[model samples]
Target: MIINQSIITDIKNIIVQSKEKAIRAVDHQRTLMYWHIGKRIFEEEQEGKERADYGTYLIKLLSEQLQPEFGSGFSPRQLERYRQFYRVFPIASALRTQLSWTQYKLLLSVDNEEQRDFYIAETIKNNWTSRQLERQIYSNLYERLLVSNDKENVLSVAKNEKFPSDAKEIIKDPMYLEFLGLKRETSYYEKDLENAIITHLQEFLLELGNGFSFVARQKRIHIEGDEFFADLVFYNRLLQCFVIIEIKTHKLTHQDIGQLQMYVNYYDRMEKLPHETPTIGILLCADKNDAVVKFTLPENQKQIIASQYKLYLPTEQQLLEEVNKELESFEEK
Candidate 1:
């Protein structure tokens, strides 16, 4: 009396899917409950009481009573969070079925409305996990993109309106590779950094931004009997071009720029299809002289991108504490 292997597999899949759906359903309900709680608290606070005093009083009293029946999720701090969640999102546009209670909580930690909205948009577009969303916020991803790219493109990303038509919109200056597990004190060679990137390729892709697929590493190309090895090669679907990266563990020089430019030329001339745009060359180095980079590249240079890499990343707890500090400062004011 044994079950068929395929039947067992099918049953296992059903159980797994059901569990996932049940979890999603529970999360959705919890998020809705929080939203409703927030709304009621806001309405009650607005009636005849001063916001600073009455709001705090209402949440504290509510938490004390609800804690005995419902456990610690109804703590005073949690109630205040719910109130803040409502205050930020409001009745018009707060509830998104796709986002869980935890994700919404992360969004609520964000102080700026536009930045919050942008995070929401990106989170939804990329289907980012709660952890990924947290990382993006702390990393100042929106701020970084806003630097080189235009405001409209940045704001309109969630609207699905022509995000990153060019390479510059997605590329970051001083790319953070703290996920590579490289130590700051240890001296590393270019190959070591490249190896780290290859090892943490998934996180590297996230740092690289959307629509990039790894093509090759140490791609060998021969030009008139001289052979050159491109450090890393990637294809960006958004920009429709090959992105060639050369890692330098030291300050960028004009000669390094020239070498990267040559690699770009080879890719554009030999590798890329006619329909694709010109190859984009990037030199990811530790430090660089902007004046040198400016003088080295052409005035109309859109293909060549040079970015510095940082080895440290802020922890989630640190970012959460920063948010708390900001909130405390605002309260003090």
Candidate 2:
């Protein structure tokens, strides 16, 4: 009798899948246990009307009693977090089974309810790991998108209630590329930056926002024997269009904007199908002047945009100041 190697491989795959499913089931049960513990504690505190005066004492006493019997996981600090978890969620039916306790713990740290809800929906949609969720929150993904777009509309997208109609809706101003491990002061060629982004493509895509898939890098174009190369090309399924990106290591100028406009026109006329929407060109530069961008494009421009890129994450205070400045500018307009 001849032994089949394919059957052996199939058995291995089945076993691995079974183990994975079992692990997920266990994790879901653990998450439910924590939520129930939080619910019970919250109910007890509310019934006794001791949350304001003796809440800390109650948690401490519970920890002292439970730790020796159960484990250190029942510490006072963890119990406090559980209490906060219940306070934030409140409804048992609203808890997501896909999120583990670790993800919920990180989500609990977000003070804004809308932001927390957005992250929750996005984490499930994107299947983000706990580390990815942490990075997104730390990078202020919600605030960055809200800086340029309407708050309600962006949150709606997060909840899957509405889709992005235009490239601008999904694109963020001053994209944070701190994951590339590049220094802002360093002088590097455009190719070097592009290579780094490619090497860390997963992190780059997260920074690029949702529904973007990589298409090409250094895509060649020829028009009447004049050749050009686009730095990066991506297709956003949500927007249903191709995105052409041009990289500049210095402040943007009218000439750069004109070049990007040509790329957009080229893609629209030559590359885009009749059923497809217009291609969008993005100028990712180290800096940009709003006035320059305003003057370079036509008054009714929609397909071309110039945005600044930062190699490092900005401090929360810096981001707050920038958002405030943008709001003030919008009010003046």
Per model, state how many residue pairs clash: 0, 0
lDDT of 1 by residue, 29-95 (tens): 8887887888898789888485568877888899989999999999999988888888888863557
lDDT tens readout by residue for model 2, 141-232: 88777766777888889888999876767788878899999987789898899999999999989889899999999999999999999999
**Candidate 2 Cα lDDT to native:** 0.87
Which run of 10 residues does model 1 get worst, by summed lDDT? 322-331
Worst 10 residues of 2 by lDDT: 48-57
What are the models' TM-scores?
0.88, 0.94
Error of 2 at 267 (Å): 1.0
